[model samples]
Target chain A: MSHDTVVTAAMLAIGDELLSGRTKDKNIGHLAELLTLSGIDLKEVRIVADDEEAIVEALNALRARYDYVFTSGGIGPTHDDITADAIAKAFGLPCDHDETAMTLLAEMYRRREMEFTEARQRMARMPRGAAHIANPVSTAPGFIIGNVYVMAGVPQVFQAMIDNVLPMLRTGTPVLSLAIACPYGEGDIGTPLAAIQKAHPDTSIGSYPRYIDQKFSTEIVVRGRAQAAIDAAGAEVHAMIGAIRRKKEVVENPSAEA
Target chain B: MSHDTVVTAAMLAIGDELLSGRTKDKNIGHLAELLTLSGIDLKEVRIVADDEEAIVEALNALRARYDYVFTSGGIGPTHDDITADAIAKAFGLPCDHDETAMTLLAEMYRRREMEFTEARQRMARMPRGAAHIANPVSTAPGFIIGNVYVMAGVPQVFQAMIDNVLPMLRTGTPVLSLAIACPYGEGDIGTPLAAIQKAHPDTSIGSYPRYIDQKFSTEIVVRGRAQAAIDAAGAEVHAMIGAIRRKKEVVENPSAEA
Candidate 1:
């Protein structure tokens, strides 16, 4: 597959619990960080309910737009676990039990002397002509159909599956970031920061404010694939903050003591 | 404004930091929970980069689909903050500094002996014919244009603005939920649970699995507006779990010693 200059991806978080606000989503952040480190840009994320139409629409939209689309949740044994079927429908394929997945799951249950019930067998189903993604935590494997990779919603299982999935995908140049903490509010240095950002168009500068210990501060981060550009922009940010602080101090307490 | 029988909402989280995996989002969960408590259904959520085109495209889609759309982040004083502009363009309205918002911010800065810089004044800009949403944390207020409520990405300010915005909107009947936890995996009782779900079409049932203390368990939640319906479904859920456990025990521990 010919990839773009910047390898990009999108995430689809499918579940009624997440939309209902009953479950605080933990997979997106984890996946985002992992993808960044692996040199894949996470461009978009859409959280939809377990409804099949919602999942299919989002799956098609994301898979067509990005290089890869990863879906979390709704792959369990329960009826609400409908991501496999949705992905199948989105790609115009039939969903059924896969022999490899069934063998893996059946053996795992047999080793534990547990009856593999029909409901347990539901986890072995996958879209036709799809390859399974190994699950380190549980034997029920996730599968990949087209550019869409389906994984579990459980954080541990999701992370484990990501470990298996990342090596299979192509990686691009990783983005390097440098953070500089300034003891000033965002408003104090917003103008200079914008100028610095313009001076280095290759690097993306971000300003995040923090109000802790009864003091206001901002953390400015510079991100890009080039280290030289990041360093140049980071130095400009440091100098700008110093200049602002010095000007504020000299004007505010200009007494004979100076 | 009149709302549909189901007052649905969509959230747009606008920021480069979120997409870059530098910041873990907190506002979505907070808003989802708050909206649910206020009898509003949060149906969809989209996390997009700070790019104006992306923001505008998502805003139009979400606002068109849902009853209300809430956006968080990118309303700060920095150059990266383009939500106000994107929102204005989405509605084909003019973006400018509102007299009311300017006065609120100017007065707050004056009282604190702070200079209201041009960058700080950027927070006062809103789409024409917009209503400002009060920000108790910082004087830089959010705004409401059409059905979209734009608020700060900072969790503190976002929560405060939500407290102000909820009362102005019409609320529907709240959905009450009951949870029943069983010491078994989802597959252990998924078939019976689905039967229960099919039997009670009015209630929405969610199954979430957990692995803690080296034990597997699943929590089944039933949600609806009617107490009688929830109670009836809750009883079935309890009985189904009991029956599953009893059958498993009888099959595993069969003995004629008794």
Candidate 2:
């Protein structure tokens, strides 16, 4: 029941497109999976627009509360990219062009034989005291300031940066889960589910109703720290579901004489 | 460059399965669309676990900053559902079983001839001085306390509740968008895209790179309040893309292309 040792993290998805529904925020799900695998509990995920004040507020609040904060978006070369400035304001620091970032970016442009315009150079600016997060895919590297790590809004780049950063993070014990799926509705098996939940107070029983093909099916998932308890609770759920199904079948097909 | 009047909102998605990667949180995208269509700027979104303290802290911070806050999940018959209690604690109010909620739930159960156990009755609890937000699809109704509206975690039920509650909300002028997509990578047209963005300071232009059918594609979206301005910007982008494509085709096939 006590999860005090859980190493929790938060996500900040910064984009106006996500808010407008033009683009679905895929970074949250990716980060959730990545963090869970790394044994870092993703306690919270947030999506904010390109606005400076909103970004700063969310950044400050999340960074203060969670062990680590990962932000995706508002780091591109466009005018809407304001994450670097906002992070600076959140930390009460000045945003300036980092020479190291500029040198790396300049080298990339030179190798590709592309002009390093002012707009492209804008990507080189970071919060005064921050280290660069390596982006293996693109030339524009993500940055980390204090507990907050800023990455690209693009899924592939963001994922690569996360993979690069996760190994260095301290993690806790990985979580384990067990589930019991049946061809029944939640209302039909609510009682037994409640009983199992009450009996195993340490485990969490989640009832999900899924519509597949033409039928409604329910999946009751039991998750906990102890594997033995999870197995026992899952067995109880299966027994209860089997009994209910058998009873219903008998009632519907009385004698099978026809 | 400046929005004279901005009515911002935040979405809080609550579920541990999401954090554990067992389930992807879909409520944020749906809520963002709903809020945007209603002319309320969905400025921020947060996904948190069923933990009470985390939910309470996020609720307090978001509700205080934004004009409205919409929270999904943790409002169920299960013990893990702690959204109501958290909201109450956040507002420094006492939570108890409401007579009105009980009556509504009892009616729903009676109509379906279902047993209304203590666990089922737990859905009738609400924070004091909160108005009920109607849930058309489900028996468990949501509640509105101050700026925060608490609803179910299920996508269909949550969306329906938002539809029911949105008509009554006061909203600002809605932002509109126009987009043009082509079968080319963003890297191919970064310079011109940057130029267009610089020219249209009022409009936010986003360049998204998508991989479809093993081919790279990019979608340039222009968003702003002015339809005429957006139309002009879209026209310029189309012309720029057309020129780029023509030049590429000419270079690749000098003899057959003509």
**Candidate closest to the true structure, highest DockQ:** 1
Model 2 chain A lowest lDDT segment of ten: A208-217
Worst 10 residues of 1 chain A by lDDT: A1-10
**Candidate 1 docking quality: incorrect, acceptable, medium or high:** medium
Q: What is the C-alpha lDDT profile of model 2 across B107-186, one tens digit per residue?
A: 98899766666767777788998999887776678999998889987777888898888987888777778878877666
Count of clashes, each model: 0, 0
Best by TM-score: 1
lDDT of 2 by residue, A103-145 (tens): 9989987896656777678788899979999987776889989
Q: Compose the digit string of candidate 1's lDDT tens values, residues B1-258.
A: 123267889999998788778899999999989888888999899999989989999999999999999999998898888999999999999999999988988998899888899889998889999998988778788999999999999888889999999999878788889999888898787888888999998888889999786456899999988888899999999999888878778878876224
Off by over 4 Å in 1: A1-4, A213-215, A256-258, B1-4, B256-258
Please give the distance, in angstroms, between residue B123's alpha carbon in candidate 2 and its true position after superposition.
2.2
